[model samples]
Target: MSAFDVRDLLKAAGHPGQLKAADAVHYAPTTSAIPPAEVGAPRDHGGAVSPVVLAGSVRIADLVLVVILGFAIHHIQLADMVGLGWRYPAAILSVAVLAVALFQAFGSYRIAAFRSFLKPALRLTAAWSLTFLVVATVMVFAKVADHYSRIWLATFYGLGLAMLLLERFALLHFVTARMRRGQFDRRTAIVGGGPLAEELIRALEAESESGIRIVGVFDDRGDTRSSSVVAGYPKLGTVSDLVDYARSTRLDLVVFTLPIAAEDRLLQMLAKLWVLPIDIRLSAKATKLKLRPRAYSYLGSVPVLDVFDKPMADWDIVTKAIFDRVVGAAMLIVLAPVMLGLAIAVRVTSPGPILFRQKRHGFNNETIEVYKFRSMYADQSDFTASKQVTRGDPRVTPLGRFIRRTSLDELPQLFNVLKGELSLVGPRPHAVHAKTNTTLYDQVVDGYFARHKVKPGITGWAQVNGWRGETDTDEKIQRRVDHDLYYIENWSILFDVQIMLATPLSLVTTKNAY
Candidate 1:
């Protein structure tokens, strides 16, 4: 037996095993370990899921269409009756709202509903019929039933239901086609390979309609214990390797198949995995240990224990994108003169490009070109930013000093925000090669990459709280990372506004600003 075999034995006995590459092959009772093959290639599915045409957006569109249809029907029927007052239009609006609300109450807009045509169609029929009944009752109670045309109301109801059903059918077709093309599926990875992993894989594969495409399996155990193939899925790599893979790919979820009773093993895995900006769930079906009902969350009908959630997900991401564009555009327009004046000053005062584009770690550790007004002499500019700029740095120009102090240099990044490369408020993007105390920022902080789970921003909690400017020491970067993680965890639109509102005051004080 090898060192890895001994390690695995120790790990099974509840000791935290060292995660490393091992060549030994060991067998479990039901599933035997196979020799490791080459890591599986990433599956290619054409195009990402369309952000604009999601189920929620489609539901809202359905509501708007219903209101529009109602208005059209009312206009056609009541055209002959002059000065009928706002009663008819108001009734139409109320009925439309109530219809959409009923649809929501009946869960007509759920993903499962979109997966099949008949389910949503039936729900839509029921919801619309209920809405019409409620509206009729309200009209009767108000003694206004006689004021509206009965034939017109009946015709509108039939037309509205027909239109909604047609819409639902169209959406169903679209979603079905997208799923077949692998565009609408969630990319998932199993965190361990064993009997439990095989069982989970079987369960997931059995429900192909669930839209979870398991990318592959990842295990820290060597071939001795963990199989190279678990239920036909290739073991991708170790948990550390999984982190890098997830960071590079569009992995939506990481499912842990390790037993919940194995607290030490689970915690060790989570310590490495939580840095990722993906949903982490412990597969409850793999273990017999059951928790309270509230402790469990479901993915379809499968119960799993929620661990860490990807920050700024789904609607929150959409909301933040819209907020960034609107506010970023407004800020650009409002600060146009200041930016214009600064641009001219930089051009005349120094011989360099007006805007400096430097590579920074973006949303997923991807290198993105972050824009800034040139604040250093062109000849002396450090594109890599390996050397930290200090107070009264000789490389800075006269104009650069003033602009850097006042943070006018960062004004050009509003365009980056407009371009969707940055957020209005998030963890500030660090230069790709930025370092502190002769070491990379990631080296100083344990879960440093976790901050990059969300998009980098122009001004963040760290910047507003005086974590900006030169990060010369390990403590400074650590503090900044701590604040960034805090912002990510507690992010809300109001919190962003609060940070943005306080930014100017923070800039004015300029404690660490060079």
Candidate 2:
């Protein structure tokens, strides 16, 4: 009955839920037929289903996948120089997965984000570098790091970059071709049915990316004042009819081409249409202040400031993913000897299984089993820690104390990297019940849910900077959360590299690494 969460409304309705019985919902194949919003922007009389947008997206994904996967195989073959007769496939697969991740993180597939290669290219380099550094640093710290060769790492990077460049070039050519034929168009409409809407529609019609197809305008004003044709787009219907047309068609954006100075009327319109799933944007040309320089992004050289961006919208995510897999797999192959040793030690020292696994909150608040060495006495390993580990804790085994301190106990979780529950670098995931000062971590931090916006890490920004181990105090966890938030907000490949480098120094000083 509800419109659902603003973020999930469109996405959820597409799912197989019997959400609103038969007449309550309307469906159309956007890939084939997109209804018009502006009178001037009509569907092709030629009856051709435009394939450019879909084709471009799919081709970009495929090309990146192949190149990234292929280069990873090459890297593994090089790592085979370390005599890994069996671990090679896993290592390569890890790289393949991370490469995909990096691509996703970087938003390589997003339409607006990828229009310029300059920013995205630099980001790709940063994301891949950080991923490699994180995996390699962890392996070296564990003391059995000689399983990989530098030559293969070099080869993989070189080949991967070459493929990336080639793929982007090919994509550019293809996208341009589609634009030429008007096959990849973002059909948009204005709601105000005013002079501003007409101007905004005209402004968008003049740009590339196949330019926007401006559908007819919508206004409730009587015909005498609000004419039939507004900015060359006919007044299709009233606001109610606009909603109906919206149900029957595919519209990428709905511009509220009204000035903020007209506060009362704008508020009324927003209340009426805010429930819809499409991007609701305000045309910002009339604003007095030049918002933050960075806040304004050009829509064909006309500056429109950002409001709600699609989360992990583009290339930034794509690149981060690439880093995760490539480095995650490398760690698994290089640290196998250490992990195998830890497994044996755990079995020898305790009655239960070798690995310690527990439910920890992961990306998007999903409950995930995080793997570690069974450090506590078998019958007493706390699924939710009743007490924090301290110096000379009796619940810890003799072996557990040493492995936990050296962090060798965490080696088996390199597979968690392979499993995709954890990233090579992120805010380390905490148990669902993890708390400080008798309060859950989430309750104490105002933006705690924001952390779940990203994948949790095995070793994170806080951990590497001496915030590891038990959270015995409120301030301790807050500081850690502060650092974690800092990492998330100001994330870059270089920052990740710095964290990886600092981890060793920080670990050796594990004064609090209970």
Candidate 3:
């Protein structure tokens, strides 16, 4: 037996006996561990699972939190009251606060852990029970047990646990059902097809609860480096093919499990793939040092390096959708009277339907029939989105220019938000054939497709910031895309509010509008 440094191995593993002292595959610890560029390369360390997932899991766990905290506090109160007979009320509020904090710290309400509470959950409950017991014991030792109410104390402890567990059970059922329907699933795709990709597939397959369904893998290389089968998932196509596939596929995540050492090739791949509207992550399993420890995340015992994270994953999308509908509905209700007047004006001015419908690009470049109040001569209306309406244009009726300038023509789009085809605020969508000069916007701009990352809106950051109106020049459309991209990069509810507030003021400026 070679007397190796077992302690060092244990320390590296962060625990004793996790691994035996062995020579194993030791290497020089002094090289830059960047991700590989090419396909079919063997990636080293499994990349860390996202910590954002953990934070999200903690928030979701709050579904069962209120009950859990209530129970623990009640139990403590009941015990204090039973001991003190009338003083339990004084201890109730303090105990409740402490229980909630302890629950949060102990990861008692983590969505992953809460999904099953019997084995780990049983341990969690027991641990908390002991914690509360110590607090009760300390109180007794301090001679403060006689003032609490006996019945109130007993009821709180017994009822709190029951409610917490019951609520958790209900929440688990709701979450699991939504997940099964792909309603709560993270749309996942794999990049590369070799040993590393195989490991990722196996790891994901093993964790059924992780809710990752591999859409497919994209590899640039042929069979020599890239396998037709990594684990069991088939190679969907090449890296360039992935660009097209992403546009068409409902992919939520793209995991590039490429080796970090292949820097040149990776940059090339990033150039082609980074333009899409999905979460991109580089897998760090094959790196030499497994990173500086902070880079890797622990998913059970497996440590992984995180490359890129997709924005608005899982519940964030749900929350945003909720916010959209609530705000959209309220706005429509508030603006109903104004919309009614606009409808009447459109009908009286143009002897046609009050609404004008035109096909336009929406979320993911999908064509949606966008509605607007008619603002031009019904017969001469540019429904095909071909002509730019210039100032002093003959195409516009007398009523048309006023509504167009005031943006009263946009009133019908509120119904689009009502129909779930649009959001209240987002990048204003353009017509499918919308182009600057002779070239289309998508072909001209390198990452123009990324603007479709989220849903389109009636009023956008671009419009509110005076990037709206006719795209008469290359510079015009380019500035609009830039502002749209900026809006996407820093979107929030407050950001939307600011843009909405600025829209009316922006309409008054009228720099580009015809």
Looking at model 3, report the run of 10 residues with the lowest lDDT sum: 20-29
lDDT of 3 by residue, 1-514 (tens): 0011222223454432232101111122221211122222211101222335544554445434544554456566544444533344345545555665667677765556545656645654664565457657767898865544455545655565565567557656765665455544555778887788888778777876665777677787877877876777667667666665555445666777778787655655655555455666666665555467676664333456554344344455556667778888898899999999888877776698888899987876667899988877878888767777888889887788887888888877878887778887888978887767676666555456557767889889889878888887878887887787777777787888888888899999976676
Off by over 4 Å in 3: 1-93, 124-145, 182-185, 203-209, 223-225, 297-307, 314-319
TM-score of each predicted structure versus truth = 0.87, 0.50, 0.77
lDDT tens per residue, model 1, 1-514: 2222223444575643433211111112222222232223232211456333486797689778988887788678767774447987788788878987888899886777888887668888999999999999988999989888898889899998888888888888888887776677778999988888998888888775567888888898988998888898888778767766665456778999998777777766765666667788889986797688777887666788877787766778788989999999999999999999989999999897999889998887778899999999999999999798898899999898888898889999999999888999999999987899688777666667778878899999999999999999989998998899889888999999999999999999867889
Candidate 3 matches the true fold with a TM-score of 0.77
The alpha-carbon deviation from the true structure for residue 218 of candidate 1, after best TM-score superposition, in angstroms, is 0.6
Task: Report the lDDT of model 3 for residue 216.
Answer: 72
Better of 1 and 3 by lDDT: 1
lDDT against the true structure, each candidate = 0.79, 0.63, 0.64
Best by TM-score: 1
Give the winner by lDDT: 1
Reference-based lDDT, residue 185, model 2: 58
Which structure is stronger by TM-score: 1 or 3? 1
Off by over 4 Å in 1: 1-53, 80-86, 105-107, 137-142
How many clashes does each candidate structure show, in the order listed? 2, 32, 40
